[model samples]
Target: MRVVVVPPVPALLSRYASLTDPVPELRAACVSAVAWLVEHDDARIVAADDQARRIGEELLAQGLAGRVASASERIETRIETGNILVMANGSARRSEKAPGHLDERSFGFDSEVEAALAAGDAAALGGLDARLGAELLASGIGALATLADLTVTRAVMDYADDPFGVRYWVVRWECAS
Candidate 1:
């Protein structure tokens, strides 16, 4: 089975850094983000197997609540030379007036974390998983499973006030060659 796992986007450094704070709000946001994925980001997700797509559709449908609006969104998946790119896999507020934009920001890693990914250190990556996971959880986003294949990602979760909101996250996973 071909599976694509997305972990937390890396750009949310400040929001996620404070582990001491009790971030009940962030945890709830993570759940909503998952459900949002199924609803808004289906088009970008691709699986060579039809069964995988079917499963994805089911999960997406189940993610919707009565309050969530029906979206005409799509998810895209592309295979590059040594990595896989999964993008446009979440919600966005498409208003012309206040088009909340999100950018691909690399993880502002401290020297230690930087050295690890740069040097292909597995232990370093594992260490990052713990630290990053805590940060993500603090930001109302949860870290999903980390793939054995080394994939890095950068994404943004941007939104305005209550009624209209835009939130999304993406993670790049290296597929076994």
Candidate 2:
């Protein structure tokens, strides 16, 4: 199974298009990852909330050329496990100019998450501190927690950044399901 973890930032969606892409690199990573997920046509999105869900759907539409899948519709098309698109992000307070302002604790938290993704360690990802994540304005700690069930055999991160003080990661994992 293929599992992809991407930030839920709305700026990546076409609806939120600006004069110039605010997150050009992030958008590129997200689009490429989504394209990879849709190659098998078994992408299932796991979002933290309504906003995350929207971003996932928008990404799917972009990947599939406007062919977006509803949750029920996607389930009906497959009986076995398939690709996973996890909409989550780390702390948004990496610097003084960050959305949540500078929080020294964010570095530790984001580093732990980055390490887990780089190592494909689900156990470490499962143990993340949601309370601290919330205090630091992490977008999808719950969604990241849900991904603990995945048994990854290999992991590759295509992008990692905190451009707007929000920690975003685009990671792909090969899982043994």
Candidate 3:
């Protein structure tokens, strides 16, 4: 099975579009990821909340546009029925400009999550402190926690950053059944 995780950043939605894109790199990552998933395989979306779900679905729909954007820059793969799309994010308070404001703890919490994503450490993801994650304004950590059940064989971190005080990641995982 293939497992992928991406944050549901509000700016990615079409409703929020502007003349100049605020999240070009992030949007590119999301589109390429979803395109890869839908090219030959259907997917299941897992999100901790409604917004995440909506965003995930939208991204999925975008894949139907049948545009890969670039042949060399994005992934190319045959797909199957076992692809998973997870909507998740780290703290919303990585800095003072963060929506939740700088809480200091956000740094550590985000770091742990980032590490788990980069390494495909499902155990570490499951071990994340739920209370602390909540306090730090982490989005979709619940969905991420659920990923512990999967036995991952490999992981690739496509993107990682805390733009606008919100830590987001684009990750792909190959899992063993």
Best by lDDT: 2
Off by over 4 Å in 2: 66-81
lDDT of 1 by residue, 1-177 (tens): 122322223222233445664433433443354454443233233332344344334333334332245432322221222222221212222233213432222123223333432343424544444434233221111112132244334323321121222333322222233
- lDDT, residue 174, candidate 3: 83
| TM-score of model 1 (CA atoms) | 0.24
- Per residue, candidate 3 scores C-alpha lDDT tens digits across 1-177 of 778899999889999999999999999988887777666566778888899888887787677557655432222342235788999999998899999999999888889999989998998888899889889889888889889888889998988988899998999898897
Arrange candidates by TM-score, descending: 2, 3, 1
lDDT of 1 at 66: 25
Candidate 3 residue pairs in clash (backbone atoms < 3 Å): none
Q: List, residue by residue over 46-85, the lDDT tens digit for candidate 2.
A: 8878999889887766776634555446544533548788
Instruction: Give the C-alpha lDDT of model 1.
Output: 0.31
CA lDDT scores, all candidates in order: 0.31, 0.85, 0.83
Worst 10 residues of 3 by lDDT: 71-80
RMSD of 2: 2.8
Q: Residue 139: error of model 2 in Å?
A: 1.5
Candidate 1 at residue 19, lDDT? 61
